[model samples]
Target: MPRFHLVSDPDDPVVAPFRAIKERDLVGREGLFIAEGETVLRAFTRDAPQRVVSLLIDPKRREKLADVFAGLPEFTPIYLAEQGVLDAIAGFHLHRGILAVGRKPPAVAARDLLASLPARAMVLVLCGIANHDNMGGIYRNAAAFGADAIVLDADCCDPLYRKAIRVSVGAVLSVPTARLSRDESIADLLDATGFEGLALSPSADEILATLKPAARTAVLLGTEGPGLSPDVMARARRIGIPMANSFDSLNVATTSGIVLHHLRFLGG
Candidate 1:
């Protein structure tokens, strides 16, 4: 069992990392992120145990989380605070009554991550995906469809953001990920790694359903308003999902689910 530290003071130094969470959320907390809710905490413990730094909980909710606590390392600190104190410390109401501060793992380069995949692999590549909700949705979809990994450009929002983690229900922890440097060409990297890069575009003549899965495949998705950049579209094999009644576009997350689901069943 982990040692339980009782916290009554809102300004306690031990829980300082969690102070004014909303304000901290905007700037982010360096390499550390808040994992809120029992579901997300469970995912963190199960998927990325080593990254867990410490946990804070409402004393009343402690009994309900016995199973989850059993999986945590003995060295991890567990802090129990009353709901009022917890709210004051967090600067917001935390109804779920469970939170964990976790550290981000060392990043893997896009090329290195791709090279480490199996002979047959499917990867989700994101360009300029700034919204945390969309990022989380894409990760959730990727995990559900058995994607080998996810690659994000440097401009993409941090997947470890608390809202994104909760939106994905911990998929951000489970999915393997790599980030591309600003100077790195996402297209060039995927092509060089022997991945057939399929760029999703509304204007493409080829239908996504008609394409066969390659030995190694990377599905490239872009931000909301403007789709993939012209440069990416030029280098990648452009494909589109067929739509009726002239519906030309879908949200990137929804599109990812459809494409990944289709690709999952395709014979390589």
Candidate 2:
């Protein structure tokens, strides 16, 4: 079991890094990110224990998550606090009473990630998806539907954002993610990697249920409002989800679930 340090004072030097969490959350934290709640903590310690810089949790969860805590490296720093101190350090009510500083894995180029996929793989490609909630939901859907990898263009939000990780129920930590550089086009990467693209757009002519997906397929989606760009749509066979007589669209994250579900389990 890892050693536990009890910290009653929120201003303690050892816990300095966790102070004023909310105000600084959106700002960059170098290469580290804060993973909140129990589920994400489990993933952080289990899947990438080395990346977990430290942890702070209320005494309430110390015993409850004993196995998780026990699995940490002997040198890993674990701080224990009461509920009040926990909230004080976070600058808000942290109902879950769990948090950890995690080092992000090294960035992988889009070309390298896509080229490394197996012959029969499903990939989720995001273009300009800026919302953290949407990023989280899409990651959850991708994990549920067995997406081999996810490719995000430069405009997308960081999937490692704390809220995104919580909303995804820790799926972001487990999913294989690759990001495209600023000047790179999603179409260029797909074409070079031999991934048959299926751009999701409301104006598309091909019905989603009718097409037979290729062994290596990429489901491309854009931000909810503008959808995929004309150039991106042209690179792949455009496909659409049938709408009702009046309704024209769905949320981008919801669309991911519907499209990825069909591609993995239903008629593609």
Clash totals in order: 0, 1
Best by lDDT: 1
Model 2: residue 106 alpha-carbon error in angstroms = 0.5
| lDDT string, candidate 2, 1-268, tens digits | 5788999998999987788887777796878888898988887777778888899999988889899978888888999999999999989998989999888889998889889989888999999999999999999999888899999988899998889999888889888999888889888888899999998767778888876899889999898778878888887888878899889889989999988888887644
Cα RMSD of all models vs. native, in order, equals 1.1, 1.4
The sequence of per-residue lDDT tens digits that candidate 1 reaches over residues 103-197 is 98888888888999999999999999999999999999998999999999888999999899999999999899999888999878987899989
The most accurate candidate by TM-score is: 1
- The TM-score of predicted model 2 comes to 0.95
